[model samples]
Target: MTGQSLLLIDGFNLLSRAHFATSYNRTDDQLKNSKGMYTNALRVFYQKIFNLIRDHRITHLSVVWDVKRDETARRKKYPFYKATRFELPEPLIHQYETCKAASDAIGIHQISLSPYEADDLMGALSKKWSGGDCYIYSNDHDLFQLLSETTSQIIAGKQGEYVYSLSHFQADYGIAPEQWVDVKALLGDSSDNIPGCPGIGEKSALPLIQHYGSLERIYENIEQLEPGLSRLKKKLIQGKETALLSRELSQITCDIAELDPLLMDDLKVSIRKDVLGEWLEQMELKIRIDSYGA
Candidate 1:
């Protein structure tokens, strides 16, 4: 919570958001260089990361990306986890390597772990290395659970930036930041294919979590819950097993091994304009390269 600020970007989340935003734009052809690499997502990603560093006076930064879908541990735990999700477009997939190279060229620390998603890596990195103020750049509400006294998640949008600090979380969700996983467990996250107790929702689950502190405590004291809620009590009792499993699916793991020593050394933001210019030129991102020295 002291000294310099560390900014972590959820690389896949940001890139996907950018790619989709530009995909339907009829005027722009998703920016391509002479090599035919899809440059739209990478351009947006780099621009946004640079803007964040400059705007926030970031001293340390890292971009974490998700590995292959089939390799994720969550998928192993529940075969249906993100099973319904569509595959990323081939063009976007093609840009993944270039994006990593661009990040390195611009002197950004980048980490991609096999069998783990960016959220889990970001969680682990923030917990282990964020000795100062830490800001997570992503649009995923799932990352809200990572909020702490020194850590917050941000989304930059047309309407302005949305920051999920501990206070903002409390005001918006009526529960402590730490209770986010429990809330998600009760309502389920369709985006990630986690099915909460059938027909149960935030309205039904929030009050119980608020009163009992957790899903575990709520189940323990279910019998003592008010008598007027007989139907609700029955639903909770019936959905007990699923709710517990959902809780496990909702939580983000933070026990990842430390990043590579070389990447750790690269965490400081320092740009070599010439090296970056060569990368931008190869990628056909002349516009970005032209603006670099400006």
Candidate 2:
């Protein structure tokens, strides 16, 4: 444990949430000054996360991103995964690029790999981030598995009251934080279109897994489960390969090479006023300068 902490953002998850909330229609250079969806999103995200850093006494932080063009081939493994989501709007897209540049200019780190999702990157970094117990910044339940006695999760929210806690994750999910990924695989994730065991859900999977100990154990004695759940167990057997594969897919990488914290030692506590100003200018935001309290 490094004693120092890091705030890891699932970058696109936050970006997408901000983009739709404002019904934003972004354009290149439209957000050049940070008025664009991405800029505004980044500002709120940065401020909110930084505030948490201040609140929690965190000494280091970074945002993890999914740089792959199409979910890093997740679609290949689970073709319908995220197939229903809308395409990212142009302004929001541009802002993502600008946001990275802005965050970088301000000296914080932004980690991404082409074949991975932010969750994967976050997981990888969490395991190997060299910092003390890591705190992941998302409610992506998929991440719940990373929780521990000291590690935790923070649910980002628009109203500033996001849910957070490894303890909550464990209590709510009925297993230790380390078991969440496998638990999710057993239940399947609707948001990502993952095909978990058809009838198994958080309720059944958590307890069943808690009692049975492992998917293999559950499968080995499928006949002994409740009759209603027996049908679900069959489905689990049918999708056994997927149930297992999704677990693999959902497991965070914990080995990403780019998340080295020492690489972030140069980051300081102050926002770069010039970078913030330029970003705002690009967005055509007519902030009264003083409003920034600069």
Candidate 3:
């Protein structure tokens, strides 16, 4: 087992959290530089990244960002997916490029696939580099599916950070982590606007998927199940199509070929005091400039 762990961060998730945490609205929360460029998002983002590296003793880091939502394959397959999400703040949108640049300058590996969501990239990368022991940082429950012997997830909870390892995932769900996609397919994800099987939820779905292994298997042995779950069987039969489609939507694509190994090698975090201080000064964050350290 490698002592080194690669940290994969969900860039948009953290960016939005930082953006909202700092300011309530676009008008009043804007932290501008002398040239009036919005710097609040990047400032908070850098500090968070710095803390993660310092606290975790992480050396390899990758920041995976979501491309435009409309450009994603999921949106094309399901038009109503994520339709309930509010529009991103314009100020936050404006600062995205700068934030990416700041991260790049900080020497962290940054990845963004034009039409794929960051979750997919993270999943693919995690699987690709599992031998190195990968830890993904995201609050999105959908990512729980990616947990494995060599991969885990760190979630920010109200109390503190929660680390979900493969064993922990199995114990919590009573099934392997990979089965999470099937569970979500049956229960649906309200946040992503995925309409799963009607009336099926964690209570009902977890056990069903755990028993059958997958949606296909469940349907194949439908006759065997109706005797035990007569009422739920009816709902399952009724929502079979929805369940199948939801599975496709809930599953993160791991076939993505986004990260080049050589490029990923270049992403090792190395703090350059001069560049770090320059960026902080530019953002008018002089007070926090010294935190990155030499």
Candidate 4:
């Protein structure tokens, strides 16, 4: 939790983004049938991620996935949340599956459990990471809550290859990562389809939450808020139950009941040169390494 470097990648996140980017540059019919020409995109992205892990010299590595979206946790909260993102183009969708296979062949572990998301899996595993900084390779803002307990950040922006450390998250958001849930609760998440206080955006949310320390507290003293915010508080009161429920739904769960990282002995391993070479050959990716570099 303190000084460890563990790479927790959101497998589908990388795959979907790669697919969309790959599709933009190449037509689907061409990519699947080409001389493994299109596989390079997936390879290059994985290679970059692999190199980042190598450069950081992580003690543990795990790729997290949302196996199926039909979890009791999510369905119980808001049935329609993330309903549409499930559909993805065929070429990139296939590539996402291939990437999982490639990761396995390379000895990197991919983790998924029933009803839990990759973010939650990372959060739980991150708690067990000992020493150094733990990183999550996702652009998902939900992960920011874990920053309170572990060194947390997301792989963000268009390419999503850039790693955002704790400081980088704060710099980008105008508030610390720990305050992310509060921020989301106030501003609401259209992506996740969680509704927040109708009028509260980042500007007003930060000061009110910072002053009061939590949404619950601010709501408890709704009468004393700034005149503008006071009017907005009425909206929060109406949706109070839903807002709190959304807050719970939005935060990544670090306490998974059944899964234990201690059982995973393959957590520490290096990617083999022969395996990497064979996969690259099959995928037809370029080698930045010399023939000897693997």
Candidate 5:
């Protein structure tokens, strides 16, 4: 916790949040610049970045993006993965690309690898920067598995920003961070279209993972489970394959080989005030360029 802290952002996640935050009660035209391009999300995106850097005293920063949805490894493995989620709005899509360009103009490291997600990139980077205090800026609960003594997750909550640490995970879930995938495997995530164990949810998943430690262990001792939990045991037995697949989908890849060569020094924040001011002016964003204090 004493070393320099690195802030790894899930780019699209933050952009989507910014879009909703600024788009409320506003039409597409109202959110657009004079050139007919969207600026609301882009404005809020930079504002959040500036705020996060100032608030966290972030020494190193990186913005991670997801490749095309169809090109993702998860979608290739399970065609139905994330199929339920709606497509990004046209305005948001425009702003997303602008945000990436703006991030680069300001000298922030932007990462996007084929077949992997922002979550995976953040996981890989967090693992690579394990020597220091690394913070994953995202609202995705699935990233909880990456929590450790040196890594935490920053979530933008309704009240304010909440930082979830290893201790917080332990206190809230009463299970190891590594066991989160197992819990999700049993409980399922409707948002992501991950069909977890049938007839199983938090009520059953939590105790099963807390008691057995893992999905495999639960199955190893399946027959020995108490008679009072016979129904839950039966559900696990029937959903074994699904649960295994769900675990695979829920788990974040923390060792992307391409990210291995990326050193912490490469991510050190070195914003070019001149470039940022010019980019903001070009985008017609109303953000206070002076607040960045690059």
Candidate 6:
């Protein structure tokens, strides 16, 4: 907590937010550049990144991206994981490429690994940078499991940005941050297609986790559950396998071997002024370089 602060960005998370924010009601043609490509996401993405850097006084930065869904280990374990998501729009895909190029041009370190999601990379990096303060920028509730004394999550909401700390999580959930995976394991995540215990929702899941501490322990002491929870115990018994599988899918991988060699010094933010200016001109964005302290 005393060392330099690191900002870990959930790359596609921010891009999708920016894209939807600017293109909600507008047509593709309305946000295109002179070269006939969409600039809406790119402009907003750049602006948001710089704003966060300044707002947080971030000394280190890393934007993490997910590998293809089919290629990820989670999808391999559960083929239906995130299967309901639609393909990205053509305009948004173009902007994603442009944003990556711009990130490289500006010297923002970008990290990605095949067969691993961005969440895993962020978790690994947060663990690796444990000596420093790490702020994970994402709205994904799945990342809640990564919260700790030194690591926090930054959720960008409509009204403003809010930091979710470990204490805030403990107060809200009435359990340790690591226990969040068990909560998800009991209730499941519809967005990710993780099927938790059947017939159990947040109402049943929260209290069970708060009392039992974890999915494993809940099963270990299933027979000891109060008579008032007979129906809950039945559901847990029926969905034991599903709940265990869901926990595996819900938990973030924190000890990725590939990320072991990366050092904090590698993530030090050093924007390339000339490259950024040229890239912005090519993209026809009107953002002033001087505003970023170039």
Global lDDT of model 6? 0.87
All models: lDDT?
A: 0.78, 0.66, 0.80, 0.69, 0.87, 0.87
Residue 95 displacement in candidate 1 (angstroms): 1.7
- For candidate 4, the 10 contiguous residues with the lowest summed lDDT are 285-294
Q: Give the TM-score comparing model 1 with the true structure, all chains together.
A: 0.90
For residues 13-108, what per-residue lDDT tens digits would candidate 1 score against the true structure? 888887777776533454566665688777777777777777777878888889888899889878999898998887678678778877776777
RMSD to the true structure for each prediction, in A, is: 2.7, 4.3, 2.3, 3.3, 1.6, 1.6
State each candidate's clash count.
0, 15, 0, 4, 0, 0
Clashes of 5: 0
Candidate 2 positional error at 7, Å? 1.1
**Cα deviation of 207, candidate 1, in Å:** 1.8
Least accurate 10 contiguous residues by lDDT in model 3: 285-294
The residue pairs in collision within model 4 are 3-131, 3-132, 4-131, 4-132
For residues 219-269, write the lDDT of model 5, one tens digit per residue.
999989856556787788899999999999999998888866777788888
- The residue-by-residue lDDT of candidate 2 on 1-294, one tens digit each, is 455776677788777676565445754444434332435555555555556666666666767788654757576666677776667777678768867877787556677777778777777666655656567777576777666655677776667656467767656656666676778778777667677777676667777778777777787887787655665666676778878877776666766555555454642235566766675566554433333222
Q: Give the TM-score of candidate 2.
A: 0.79
- Estimate TM-scores for all models: 0.90, 0.79, 0.91, 0.85, 0.95, 0.96
Better of 1 and 3 by TM-score: 3
Tens-place lDDT digits, model 4, residues 1-294: 443467778887776766666667665565663454346248546765767566666667788878766674686556877765556666666676787778888777888887787878888888766656777777776787777445666565656456566666666666666567877777778776777767666777777766777777887788787665676677667867766766777777788877763654467646676787887777667665332222
| Residue 135 shift from truth in candidate 6, angstroms | 0.4
| TM-score for candidate 6 | 0.96
